[model samples]
Target: MDRAVLRDDMVDSLEHEAKGWINTESVSLAMRSVPRHEFVPDEQRAYADCSFEQFGTRVLAPSTAARLVEALDPTPDDSVLIVGVGVGYTAAVVAEIVGDQNVQAIDITRRLVWEARNNLARAGYNGVLVDRHDGSDGLPAYAPYDRILLEAAAIEPPQTLLRQLGASGHLVMPLGASTQRLVSVSKDGTTVDEFGRVAFSPMLVDGEQVDTVERNRTVREDREFAARESEGRHGWEQHWIDWTHGQKH
Candidate 1:
């Protein structure tokens, strides 16, 4: 079967009433146009509505990507930023809608950044920029994007990312710590519309990428333990000398 036919089939499933993931025509067309097989390791499974793991990051399921892009609702030629580029599949879809030159993406993991770059290029979206940067900080050099999509979960919208949104922009993310919900926030950060529950890995900070030798939390936790021990009393200090108390009695 042709890859294009496979892609059409994938989009059809997403638009079908059973899934209803692709609600808008733009998303439907974009998904169909972009060749998902070029972005995933397994061309055989590329159109499957299932997720894949690559370079320690997740290649979101087609349905999940459709939901995100639909929520993002990017317009043609809109400047868009995609945090957590993953395998660059979502970025390619967005590029189809917004033009490759109008899309910029970033990832905290260096290897994944390279992976996304290669994948995007292979998928004929070389104009889209994929950089290795902390997702929280965003790509500030190209700040004030018309639309922002965060693929990772964050406890709250990153303030820096919010600051980078254009005056009339929308930032969509899986918001929450333990229980995540897909949400879209207005540029002012006041008008938030939730689109039900989702589960995504928490956003990674510096030194927390899968390739890092030591996680940031481990070093921070060790320092915290040391500080607590220093502030605490030792064995002899814990046992009060009762000389003064006994004399008073």
Candidate 2:
């Protein structure tokens, strides 16, 4: 099957699943225009609406991206910031609506950033900037974006990223540590409204990836220290008895 037809079918699925909740033409056209298969691994089936892993990162499902793009409501001249540039697919869709030069996307993973850059350029979205930076910090060098979207979930959108939003701008993100909600926040440096829910991967912090080995080692050490303290407490408690709760004053 032709890649274009496959992309069109994917967009149709996005429209269908949206169930009239999201049917924005710009969003649909952009979804149809960009080839998702190019960003995804060749071995896997790409035309499906389901999310998959690429470059050790998760791609948002087609419906999720559609809803996010619709909520963002980008314009051709708008400057957009994408917090998680997973394989550059979402960035590409946004770039198609807003010119590529106006789009800046970042990821905490260095390898993902590299893959995004290559995938975006190959897909003819070379104008979209893909970089290895903390999504929380955002692309401050290009501050005050007209629109901002985060592909990861956060308890609250990062202050720094929120600060980068232009006056009269809109930002969308998944709220809550767990049981995430898709939230849309519009601000002009004052007066904010955040509501909605959707689950997504947790945001990377300080632009650093989780070090599982180090984390596990720390957990073990803390447990051992806690056990030692607990054993000592029982021995010392007998000597330092509390009169209020005991027989002796």
Candidate 3:
């Protein structure tokens, strides 16, 4: 089957009543234009509505990507920053909406950075700049982006990323720890509109990349200390002592 036809079918399913992920025309057109197969390892399953794991990162399914892009609501010429550029599929889709050169992406893992670069090039979106950097820090050189999208989950929006957004810009990400919700936040970090629930991997710090050696001893020690503290707690200390739970002893 033709790749273009497959893309059409994929978008068709996304826009259908059962799964209305692709709402706007921009997102619909962009998803159709970008060749998803070029960014995925398994070309045969590229258009399937399923996620893939590559280089220790998750390649979001088409419906998930469509949801993110639709929430982003990017326009042509908008400067967009994409954190956690897994397989470059989402970046490619964004590149179609915004000009290719207007898209900047970063990943914590160096290998995934290389893979994303190569994948974008193969997909004819070489204009998208991809670099290996901590997603929390963002691509500062190109600060003040019109829109920012973080593909990973974060307990709270990174302050640095919020500072990098243009005065009127907004950021979309999966926010929280145990449970996550897809949200769009204003530049001032005040207004947050939740799209729905979503699940994504936690954002990686500087030394946490899968390819990097485990050399951050401080983090390891902190975890061990917390474990020891938990073990030491007993009886009332086992859980938070609620004065309201008991009247006087």
Clashes of each: 0, 4, 0
Compared with the true structure, model 1 gives a TM-score of 0.85
lDDT of 1 by residue, 196-225 (tens): 899987777776885545434433245556
> Against the unseen true structure, what C-alpha lDDT does each candidate score?
0.86, 0.76, 0.87
lDDT of 3 by residue, 8-29 (tens): 9999999999999988999988
- Candidate 3 lDDT (Cα, 0 to 1): 0.87
Candidate 3, RMSD to the unseen true structure = 4.8
lDDT string for model 2 (1-249, tens) is 788888887777667754543578888888888878778766246677677655566777777777788878898989999998888888998999999999999987887888899999998998998888877779999989899998887765577887898887878887765477776776633325444567776776652463332312222234556777777786337566676676644
Candidate 1 CA-lDDT value = 0.86
Q: Give the backbone clash total of model 1.
A: 0
Whose lDDT is greatest here? 3
The residue ranges of model 3 lying beyond 4 angstroms of the native Cα positions read 211-249
